[model samples]
Target: MRLTVLGCAGSFPGPEAACSAYLIEADGFRLLVDFGSGSLSALQRYAGLHAVDAILLTHLHCDHMLDACTYVVVRRYAPDGPYPPLPVYAPAGAPDRIATAYNISGESVDDVYTFYGLQPGSFPIGPLQVTVDRVNHPVETYGVRVEHGDRVLTYSSDTAPCEALLRLAQDAHVFLCEASYLDGVDNPPDLHLTGREAGEAATKAGVGRLLLTHLVTAWGSEASTFEAAASSFDGPVEIVRAGARYEV
Candidate 1:
């Protein structure tokens, strides 16, 4: 399995990166996790506009899903004519929320996307087996674990420290986690995880490697975030870089 970092900036796009988005490919199947703001353009760097086979959204936040609105336009009016409705798995009320965000009337959004409400369970998407668990976030968020053959990758979409996240990350070959807060600063509860927290979670889960992501540039330096994570986790830890690819 191959994992590509499409974007890693938190909350909003930074000067060098977009918001959260990742591309996972295995056995000729392409799956996209999170289509955040500015990600559609970045995605074109690595894949054709229509190459994505399926999408999984962790939550409905603008930084995580807003680009999906623009994607509808691309799919609906492409020169080849409208493509088949793409499968999108997201939290409940996602269709209505996306319709509202896109400001489209009637079933226009539905014409481009076939929405499926995500639940806490395991399901198969092409060659990958995915397990979803509810994480600690204000909204209905899910952390996903993807397994293909002997390889496993876990993504902590956006969450505070929680048991569900640890369980989902257990024994994962790569733990892609969000580190949105400064190490020693105070942050709102049930919102995001600090680099230390993310590292600790990875340690507790006994993951093989930890890749820190979702760094809010305004909060502090990215290097400091890496330091904070390394302080807690004894295994390999690195910050995610956009356009970088990892084999799992």
Candidate 2:
């Protein structure tokens, strides 16, 4: 599996990065993990607008899903005409929420996207095996574990410390985790994880590599986040950068 970090900024777009988005490709199929704010423009640098086969949304937060509305416009009124409706897997009420965000009729958004409600279970997307689990978050959020052949890649969409995340990341080749809070700081409960907590989870899960993402630039420097995560995790740890690609 090939993983590409289209954007990695947390909560909002920073000067140097966008919000949360990733592209995964394997066996000639392309799957997008999230379509966050300013991600569409960045995605164009890697793949065409119509190249994506499917999209999986972790949750309906604006930072993670707002660009999906812009994508609807791109697909609906392209030069050639409307493309086939793309399949989108997301939480319940995603279609309605996106429609409201787009400020258009539901049919308009539905015409461009065929929405599938996500549940806590395993499913197949093309050649990839996907497992979904509920995580610790204020909203109905999910973390995804994807497997292709013998390689496993787990994405912790956005979550605080949770058993479900640890289980999903078990023996993963790559753990794409969110480190939204700094070490030794007070953060709200059930919202986000500190870098140290992320490292602890990576260590406990025995993942091959840990890629820290969803960092808010306002909180601290990327180097500090990497240092905090590396302090706990014994294995390889790095911060995610937009436009960077990794093969697993």
Candidate 3:
């Protein structure tokens, strides 16, 4: 499996990064993990606007899902002609949230993408084995675990430290985790993870690599974030860039 970071900035977009999005590909199938604010523009850099085969939204938070509304416009009005509806796996009420963001009714957008409600379990998407579990977050967020053959890729959508996340990411090749708070900050509980917390989880899960993301400089320190993760986890660690790609 191949992983591409379309956007990784957290809460809001950075000057050079979008909010939160990732592209996972294997067997010629492209699965989008999240379509956050400003990510659609970044996505066009790595693949065609119409090239995405399916979408998996972690939650309805604007930073993680707002651009899906923009995607409806792209697919609905593309000059090449409207393509077949894409499969969209997302949290319950996703269609309504997306439609409301688009300023249209849910039924109107339903024709553009087939929506599947996400739950805690495993399923198949194309050639990949996919699993999702509820995470500790304000909204109904989900962290995804994708496996193909012997390789495993897990993404922590947006969450505080939780056992379900660590269990889901066990032995993963890559753990794409969110670290929105700094090492020494007194962050609130059940909202986000500090960089140190993310690294500790990766260590406990025995992941091959830890790619920390979801940074908002306005609220957290970026340089210190990486430092904190590195101090806790003994593995390859990086604060993912907007277009960084990795093989799993």
Where model 2 places Cα greater than 4 Å from the true spot, the runs are 104-107
Tell me each candidate's TM-score: 0.98, 0.97, 0.97
TM-score of 2: 0.97
lDDT of model 3 at position 73: 82
* Pairs clashing within candidate 2: none
Can you write out model 2's per-residue Cα lDDT over 1-248, one digit (the tens) per residue? 99999889999998878899999999999999999999998899877777699999999998899999889889899999789899999999899988888875555587889999999999998899999999999899999999999999999999999999999999999999999988776788999988999999999999999999999988667777789899999999989889999998
lDDT for each candidate structure: 0.92, 0.92, 0.92
- Residue 31 in candidate 1, Cα distance off native in Å: 0.5
Estimate the TM-score for candidate 1: 0.98
User: What is the alpha-carbon lDDT of model 3 when measured against the actual structure?
Assistant: 0.92
Candidate 1 collision pairs:
none
Candidate 3 residue 199 Cα shift, in angstroms, is: 0.7
